[model samples]
Structure formats: C-alpha cells, structure tokens
Target: MNAGALVLVVVQVAVMVVLSPLLVGVMRQVRARMEGRAGAGVLQPWRDLRKLLGKETLQADGTSWVMAAGPVVLLGSSALVCALVPLVGTTTFPLVPDDLFVVVSVLLLGTVALALVGLDAGSAFGGMGSSRHMTIAALVEPTVLVSVYALSIPVGSSALSAIVEARIADPASIASPVSLLALVALSVAVLAETGRMPVDNPSTHLELTMIHEAMVLESSGRDLAWLELGSWLRLGALLGLVGSLLVPWGIAGDVTVPALAVGVLALALKLGVIGAGLAAGEVFLAKLRLFRVPELLAGSFVLAFLAVTASYLVVQG
Candidate 1:
C-alpha cells in the first residue's frame, strides 16, 4: 500500500479507538439533558472503561470457550469494519474485493458469536436476550443489505471505496430522489442495528424489555468493557459509512497533512450531528414493542427496494 493509504488506515483506527467512548459519552449527556437531568461529562465513558479494565474478570462455572472468545471476536470484528470503511479517504484494505459485503457479514458474525456466548452462560435472561437479539437481527440484516445495495447500484460496485468515489465524482447524484429515499431507509436500519430508540431502548435494563443489554448481563469488568467499546465502535463505523456515501462533502481523497486534517474534522462533525440526532430521537420517541420491530424493518426494506427500482428507472430514462 502507498504511504497515504497506510496513514489513512492508521489514523482511522486511532480515531475509532479514541472517539468511540467519547461518542457514547456525548449521547448519554445529550439524552440526560433532554430528559431534564444533570448530564454526565463527555469523559464519563472513558472513565468507566478504565475502571472496568482495571477490575478483575469473573466467569460463570458453566461458561465455555465461546464465552471467553466472544468479546475478543466482537472487538476484532468492529476494528475490521473500521479498517474496511473509508473514513479519511479510502480503505487501506480496498484490494479486498468484497469489503462492503464483508463489513456487513462481519457484524452478523459478531452478533451470532455474542448470542452463542450468551446462551453458553445458561442464564435465563441471557437466553431470552439472545433470542430477542436473533429475532431483531433477522429483521434488520436484510434491510441493511438492501439499503446498502440501493446506494451501490448507481456506482456499479459493492465495494465501499467505489461508492464513496462515485459520490465524490458526481456529488449532485446524492441529492437525487432515489438516494434520498435510500438514506431514509438506511437511517432506520442504523437505529435498529445500533440499539437506538423506536427499535430497542439502549438505556433500559429491565429483562422484559432488554434486547442487547440482557445478553451482556453476565459479563463483568474487562469483558463488559470490551463489549461496550465494540458497540460504540460499531456505531461510529456505521455512521461513518453513511456519511462517506450519502454526505461525502469534506472527505479527503489523499492523505496529505491538510487532507488528513480536513478528514478528521469532517468525521468529527458528521458524528457529532449523528450523535445529537440519535439523542433527540431517543428523547422524543418511545421504544417499539418487540412485535413491532419486524414491521419497522420490513418498511425499511420496502423503501430500499423502491429506491433500487427508482434508480434503475432514472438511469434507463
């Protein structure tokens, strides 16, 4: 790889490592303020992670190797997603022909790993949570693939770099009606995948309503910390992908000092806006019942399908 690509990869990885916790912190602070409570500092998540890392790990007697490997795999997969995505310019791993599809599938792999680990613990809540998680994943994954494919159709390639390059080469194309519809579809998929409100409640701890958190109920200390960090990193990477494709303005194509600086600033700004919007949505909306999730995801899938059809019609015309 060229130095520019190498530098971009390094910078993107560093940004994911540092900024993941900060993004979580910002969301918590925004949610607190919106709910009329004293907000935690933006560094609160960092402090929590540090404390968790310093504490000792405890495992249940029935836990299997899958339980032990789940967190590592989760973190590794998220890091891989970060590397595959075009954060600064393009991925250093752009030569990997199926990076976009791999990015989507790796997320599913991590989720399945965690679900199996949750079941291995043999806790009632863990099993229940895993079941719900699988259900949600089943509903969400197809929408995510369809939505991404809608964006990929115009570019004629499923690789993330090609999508971003296509957007940058013809910036006006993103404002088309089909792209707008796909953006809306993908935005809903993002919420569902990220455990945001109107899909799943991130702050809820009750076993009856918990989807993501219940699966991690048995995790403590370092394991829990890594899982939480992985979630945050995944969130940022998803939002970054959306920004790169739908809002490619200010993204740097080269890794010169100036370009890298601009890329960092653009990433930060986009994430900030996304974080605030998530917080607002959480404050304003209520979580859907478990049964309603499928309908929501199905709606997104239909919209995405429409986007693909519309794009074809426009191109043909």
Candidate 2:
C-alpha cells in the first residue's frame, strides 16, 4: 500500500515479464553450446513469442471453455507470483505478505490451470501428461512448503520478504546447516516444478519421455504463447527466489531509485548465473524415469525434514 511496495510490485512484474524469456533463451543457449550445436541467440525466445502471438489459435470440437480460459489463468497466476514474491526488492505488500504458503498456492493455481488445459485437450498424450504432471505436483508442493518452512524457522515468520531481509541483516545465518539443507531441498523442488532436467526435459518431445511438452501438443498460436510465457515466468521467478534466499544481497530494503536499479542488476546476474549452472549441470545428467522421479522428490522431502529438525535443535541449543 505504501509507495515503496507499490513501486516494487510494478517493478517486479515488469522485470519478470521482460527477463523470463531471456532467461529461457540463456538456458537453451548454454545447453546448445555444451552439446556442440549452433545455439539460438538469447533473443530467440522473444522472437518465438512474437511469432506465436501473430498466428491463429485453433480449438477442437467438444472442448469446454477451459481450453480458452486455462492459458489466461496460468499466465495471470504466474504474473501474480512475480508481483508477490520479493524477487528484486524486500518491500512487503500490506494486504498480501509474501508468505511461503501464499506463494506456493499461487504457483499451484498455475499448475492446476496447466493440468486442466492438458485434460481439456482430450488426447492420450495430453491425459498422460496431465496425470504425470499432477503426480509430480503432489510431491513437489510439499517439499516446497516444508523446505521454505525450514528457512522460516530462524526468522519466526513465513513471509519470504521478512526471511530475506533477516538473512541480509544476519549474514552468518546464510551459512548455517539449516539454511544450506533447506535451500538444497528447495532447489530440487524448483527443478521438478519447472520441468527442468532429471525431472522433465524442457526441450524433448519423445512421447514416452515428455511431460510438459506432451500436455501442450494441442495448443497453437497465442494459446501456446501464453503457456510458454507462463512457464518461463514461473521458472524465472522461482530461480529468483532461490537466488535471493541463497544470496540475499543487493535487494533494496527501502525502495529508492538507485537501490531499485542495483536490485534489478543483481537479480539479472543471479538468474543468468543460476540458469547457466543448471544448463551446464544438465549436460551431464539424464532425465529420470517417471517412476524414479518420486524417489528423488522423496529424498528432497527427507532433506527438508532434516532441515526443520536442525532448525528446531539449533533454536533450542
């Protein structure tokens, strides 16, 4: 409600929209170079979006309004997430604090919207993808909550902005066992939730192997554009969350023009570094089998549980 928070919200949304596609392109370029291929430039995702937006959208018969509504819902939810999560600044919204549960719920809204869109498509691949997507979602969401809850323990607040601010205030806590364990757990969950390697391949279309791609086979034109952009924003924002939590530096505690400018640069740097690292790491990895993904997620859950226990023990000690 204050000027700082209002300005930060606008800035967060604008930066997420503008940076997400570029982040995706950077990841792709990284992977391409690793694989010894001529890479599409970092501006490629923007080019693709422009092309998709200009094409006509097609819908099949007997599909409900979900076909039309789902993409909008997904994109809207992702944009809201960018606005709510303190990606570049720590100014908290008066009405809706950046609580971990609230952020995860908004993310779930987008996930559900995408699943419904897949189911509405009425193809075998779509149904299969939806089932798989929901299965992963069921596992990933709990890890996200529990891991972030661990981070919230020391600060005694679930608001992400507060947690980040606390980390900035106390640099030593960033190196604590609780913080490291929880961050690792959350990072794995982020990879799974965003359709990254070892969970789902963002670039693959092999019918038996694809999860996110299978669901979107039926969408075209602007519909597809919305879906792609929404997914990219989710990835960008979650990566920003990880970056902010892992290194809570340069985020403006009190929003000023100079501070905001520094925050934006810091965020862009973090996203690029993390995206490139992820891509480079994925080069040496293979997508896990659908059945094996549960084990990986379950392992992350155990890490989160340990982090929670460690946090409590540390507090007691």
Candidate 3:
C-alpha cells in the first residue's frame, strides 16, 4: 500500500477501536433515559473495559487450549474486519483479499471460535448459549449472504471495493426496490448480530433470555475484556458495512484530506442514526420468545430472497 492508504488503514482501525464502545454506551444511555431513569454516561463502556484490563484473569476448571486460544482468535478476526472494511475510503487494503465473501467468512469464523470456547468452558450456561447462538446464526446466514449479493447485482461485482466504488459513482444504484428490501433485511440483521433490542438484550443478566452474554458468563478480567471489546468492534465493523454498501455517499474515493474528513463525518452520521433507531426499538418492543426468533429470521430470509429476485427482474425486464 502507498503511504496514504496505509495512513487511512491505521486511522480507520484506531477510530473503530476507540469509538465502538461509545456506540454501545450511547445505546445503553438512550434506553435508560427512555425508561425514566438517569442513564450512565456514554463513556461507561470505556470505563468498564479499562477496569477489566487492569484486573487478573480467572480460568474455569477443565478448560483446554481452546479456552486460552479462543479470545485471541476472536479478537484477531474482529481486528481483521476493522482493517478490511471500507470505512472512509472506497478501497481494500493492499495485499488483503478484497472479496465480500472473504469478509463474511471471517465473521463466521469468529462465531465458530466463540462456539468452541463456550463448549470448552464446560458450563451448562455456556452450552445453552452456544446452542442458541448457533441456531440463530444458521438462520441468519442466508439473509446476510443473499442481501449482500443482491446489493452487488447492480454493480456486477462481489468485490467490496467495486461495490462501494460503483455506488459512490452512481448514486441512483441504491434507489431500487431490491436495495430497499435488502436494507430492511440488513436492519433485522443488525439487531440479531449485535445482540440488541427485541432479538437479545445486551444489558440483561437473565439466563433464559440472553444469548451472547451466557456464553461469556465464565470469563473474568482480561479474557472478558477481549470478548467485550471484540463484540463492540464487530458491531462497529458491520455497521460500517451497512453504511459503505447501502448508503455509500460521501465516502472518500481518492487520497485527499478533505475527502477523508467528509467520509468520517458521513459515517458518524449514519451510525448515529442507526444507534438511535436501535435504542428506541429497545424501549418500545418486547423481546421475542425464543421459539419465535426463527419465525422473525424466516421473514428476513424471505425479504432477502425477494431482494435478489427484484434485482434480477430489474435487469431482465
């Protein structure tokens, strides 16, 4: 990579790492305020992570190499995505694989790593979390895969850079019915993937209602810190994808300071809108019973399928 691209890569990764937790905190604060309680400050997640890093870690009994290795792999995968995603610039890092499929696989790889860690921990809560998480994951995959491909159909390429570049060049590329439906599918995806709102509550300690938290109940100190940071970073990366792929205006297409500043402002605006919507939904909607999650995801699957069909029909007609 040239010096400019290298700088952007570092800047984007640092921004993501520093700001992801703030997004989570904002959501929490907003939800708390809506419920008539004074919320913690938006820097609460930052404070929690800082404290966790200083404390000692405790490992569960009978945990194998998987327990030790899992967080490293999980954090690595999340970091890889932060590096790969087109946050402010419409290009992939040089020498990094540029396909969206590669990006999706890396995401799924993180999920699999977490599942392994949960099983390796040998806690009933961990196993329950793993099973529910995997089940939701399997149902959600088709919607994600199809929605991405549907968005790509207009650009005629699955490369992440190409899709971003195409939409940046042709602003009308996102105005189609396919794009609209695909956006809804992705909206549903954001909730499930981020463990937010009606899908899963991030702040809850209830074992019967939690999916993501249960898996990490045994982690303490630095290990828990990695998981918490990884989760927020993962959400940030995915939200970046939603912005870059669906609403790609104002992203930098070249190495210019002015363009990069515009890109950062644009992304912040988009993520802010998304975070507010999620917080409001949390306040208004009730959590789905576990059995009904599949039904909700199935509806998302149909929307994604329709999005793909609509994209093809637009071309064919």
Best by TM-score: 2
Instruction: Point out the worst 10-residue segment of candidate 3 by lDDT.
Output: 90-99
Q: Return the number of clashes found in candidate 2.
A: 0
Which residue pairs overlap in candidate 2's backbone?
none
Give Cα distance to truth, residue 163, candidate 1, Å.
Answer: 1.0
lDDT of each candidate versus the true structure: 0.83, 0.93, 0.82
The window of 10 residues in a row where model 1 has the poorest summed lDDT is 90-99
| RMSD (Cα, Å) of model 2 | 1.1
> Model 3 segments beyond 4 Å from truth?
none
Per-prediction tally of clashes: 0, 0, 0
**TM-score to true structure, per model:** 0.96, 0.98, 0.95
CA lDDT for candidate 3: 0.82
- Pairs that collide in candidate 3 are none
Order of candidate numbers by TM-score, starting with the best: 2, 1, 3
Q: Give the per-residue lDDT digits (tens) of candidate 1, residues 14-59.
A: 9988887888889899989888889988899999999999999899
Q: Write the per-residue lDDT of candidate 3 for residues 143-225, one digit (tens) a residue.
A: 88888888888878877778888877777777778888998897787678777767887778788787999888888898889
Which of 1 and 3 is ahead in lDDT?
A: 1
Against the true structure, candidate 2 reaches a TM-score of: 0.98
Comparing 1 and 2 on TM-score, the stronger one: 2
